[model samples]
Target: MPKLLVTAFDDEFCDEVVKVLGSKGIHIHGGNRVVSIDGNSQVDSVSLENGSKIQADMVLVSIGAKPASDLARQPGLRIVENGSIWVDEYMRTNAEDVFAVGDCAVKRDFFTRKAAPVWLASTATAEARNAGTNIYGIRVLHQIQGTISAFSTQIGGVAFASTGMTCRACQKEGFRYVTATAVAPDRHPGMLPGASELKVKLVFADRSGIILGGQVSGGFSAGELINMIALAIQKKVTVRELDMLQIATHPLLTSAPTVHPVINAAHQALAKLRAVGRELPPVKKAA
Candidate 1:
C-alpha cells in the first residue's frame, strides 16, 4: 500500500482527487487545503503555500492549472489573472474568430453577472456548441447560466455532494441568501439496518426566492439528492415548488416525499427569509 500524500488544495480540483483517493481506504491527514505526509518512501516533503510542509512517500502536487492562454495572449489578446482567454458574450475574444474554450477561456455567469472559472465539461461543451453554430451564420445562445459549482465524492462507502456556493462563499460574495438545513435518517424509519443519516442544506436568494445552492451529506441518497438540488437551483426553483413537489419515497428506499430532507430544507430557508423580513418572490418553475 503506497502511502499517497495529497497536496492539491485548490477549491476547484482538490475535491476531485479527494473523492477518488477516498476509494482506496488510504489515509488523508491534511485539512481542507493542507496535507502533510511523514512516512511515504517514494516522494519527499513538498513545500506549498503559507509555508506549510508535508512529508510523503509520494507527493501528488495539484496546483490548480492556468488556462492555456499563451496562444491568445501572444497576439495581444487579454488574459485573466488566472490565464484564461477573455471573451465576449458570443465567445469572441479580443482577437476575432479565435475562439477559446475548454480550460482556455473565461466564462461569464448569467445569474451573478460575474466572470468565474469554467471547469465544468458541460459548460465547455455548451460554449463550444454555441460558438460552432454561430461562427458562420445565425446568432444563438449568448451566455452561460448561473454556475452552481456542483461536485460530489464517495468516501468510505458514503457519498457527499455540494452545489451552488458554500456558506463561506455566499457570505463573501455578499449574496442575500437564506439557508435551511435538515438532518434526517435516510430510508425513513430510524431503526432500519441500512438506514443512514443525511444532512441537507438548501440556500436561496431572499429577494428572488430562487434556490441559490445546496449541500448534502449522506449515503446513496446524496448522489441523486444533490442533483435534484442542482436542478432546482439551475431552474431557479422556489421554496413553494419544493413544498408542492410530488415525489416518490418509501420506508425502505427513502423518506416520505412530503417531508423529504431536500424539500424540508427549502421550507427551512423560507422561514429564515421571512424572519429577516426579506420578501419572497414567486420562483419560476421549469417548463
Candidate 2:
C-alpha cells in the first residue's frame, strides 16, 4: 500500500483522527502549509513549508467552499461580509418576497451568532423546509436560527462524527468549558460479533453544564449517535439532564445499558464539575 499524508492548518480533533489513521499507517501533518506541489507532466512530489518533501502519486485538496452569490448580487440582494446572501432566521432575504437558503445564504454559529462558513446538504434541506413553509407567510413557528455544523465521515473502516462547537471553537470564542470522554463496545458483550469500540466525547459549558458539542468514533453506530448529540445540543441539554437520559439498549445492537458511551460521557463531565467543587443547578423540568 502507498503511504498517505493528510495535512491541515489546525489541530481541531486531529489527535483523535491521528490515533485512528495512524494505526493504519496514514500520516497526519497539522500546523503545516503546502508550499508547493512538485510535478512534471504527471504528479511527482509535494513540498511543505516546514522543509519536508513527500513523494506522492496524487494530491487531493479539500480547502472548503465559498458561496456563489453572484446571481443574488445581480438582483440587489443584501450580501453579508462572508459573501453569502443575508437572510433571517426564517430564510427571508432583505428584499421583500425574496428568500435564500443553503450554501448561497449566510449562516451564523448556533452558539456564538457569528458568521459560519458551513455548507452541507443536510443543512440545506432543513433550510429549504423552513423557507418552503414560511414563504406563503410564517406558517412554521420553529425555524433554523443558526448552523450547528454537524458532520460525519467514514475512514479506514471507522466512522467519525462531530457537531456544534468544538473545544478549540469554544476556546476561540472565550467560553469556559469542560470535556469528558467514554469508551465501550458497541455491543453489550465485548465478545459479540460485529462489536466495535465506540468512543464518545462531549463538551459542556463549565458553569451551566449545557452541552456545547460532541464527537463520536467507532462503527456505523457513531453516525446516528452524533445526530442524537446534535439534538441534545440544540435542545440545550445539560450534563445533569443527559446523565439521566433514558435509552434502550440491546445486546446485538448497542452498548450495555450500564456503559452507554453518551450517558457515561455526560456522567463523567458531571463528575468533573463536582470534583472542582462546582455546585450544579437542578435540571429544569420541561414545560
Candidate 3:
C-alpha cells in the first residue's frame, strides 16, 4: 500500500475512512494539495503544496475534473463556472427545446439548495428520465431540484456509505441540526458467524426534526442501509418518525431485535430534541 488521501465534503465520514485505511496499513495524507508530480513516461515521486514529498515508483495523479461543455457551448448555451451546461430542475437548458443531463449538467444540493459539483450516473439517469418525461410539458408530478448524492465504497471488505448532507455541511450551511451515532452488531446474538459491527450516524434539523443525512460503515449490508436513509431524506422523514420505524429482523441477516442502528440513532436525536424543548421558555396559555 502507498500513501493516499481521500478528500470530500464530509469531514467525519472522511475521518472514518482514514481510520479504516490506517487499519489496513495505508497512510492517508488528507487535506493537502498535490503541488507537482515528478514523473517521466512511466512514473516517479509526488510533491504536495505543504512542502512534503512522497517518493514513488508509480503515481496516480487525480486532482479533479470538470464537465466537458465544449459541444454544448458551440450552440451558444449557458455554462457554469465549472464548464457544465446550465439546466433547470427538469434538465431543460436556457435554449428552447434544449435539455442537458448527466455530468455535463449543473447540479444543486438537495438540502442546501446550493450549486453542487456532484457528478454521478445515478443522478444523470434520474435527470434523463425526468427530462424525457417532461419534454413537452410538466407531466411528472415532481422534478429534481437538487441531488442527494448517495454513494458507497469499500476498503478491506468493510463497506462505508453516506447519503445527503453531513454535520460539517450542516454547520457550513448554517442549518440548525442535531446529530447522533449508534453502533450495533450486524448479526443477531453478536456471536453469529461473519457478523460485523455496524455504526450509523444520523443528522436532523433541530426545529422540524427532518432527517438531513446519514452515514454507515460495516458489512455488505451497509450499502443498502444507506439507500434506506437516502430514501428517508428524499421523503422528508422526520427523526421522530424514523425513531418509530418498524422493520423485520432475523438472526442471520440483521442486528439484534433491540439494536437497529438507524432507529437507535434517530431515537438519540429525538431524545436531545426533547431535552432542548424542556430547557426552552414555555408560552402562556391563551385565555
Best by TM-score: 2
Tens digits of per-residue lDDT, candidate 2, 1-287, equal 01122121024345656777888998887677889999989779999888999999999988667887888999899999678999988999999999998999988989989988888899999999999998898987756868888888888788888898777778788999999989999997989999999988899999999999888878899999999998998888999999999999999999999999999999999999999978778988879
Tens-digit lDDT track for model 3 on 50-150? 89988888776566799888899998999986898998878889999999999899898897777788888888899999999999997986568688988
Candidate 3 or 2, higher lDDT: 2
Candidate 2 collision pairs? none
TM-scores for all candidates: the values are 0.74, 0.91, 0.89
- Give one digit per residue, the lDDT tens place, for model 1 in 1-287: 11222111123334444555677756454443443444454557755445667655665667556666677777999897578787766667788667776667786654575776648786678678877877876477644553556667666666667777665557777887777788788876778889988878777777877777777766788888888887877766887677677788889989656568887887787777778878766645457
**If the candidates were sorted by their lDDT against the true structure, best first, what order would they fall in?**
2, 3, 1
- Indicate whether candidate 1 or candidate 2 has the larger TM-score: 2
lDDT-best of 1 and 2? 2
What would you estimate as the lDDT of candidate 3?
Answer: 0.83
The residue-level lDDT of candidate 3 at 246 comes to 80
lDDT of 2 at 75: 84
Worst 10 residues of 1 by lDDT: 1-10
Count of clashes, each model: 4, 0, 0
Off-target runs (Cα >4 Å) in candidate 2 are 1-13, 23-25
What overall lDDT goes with each candidate model?
0.68, 0.85, 0.83
Please give the lDDT score at residue 114 for candidate 3.
71
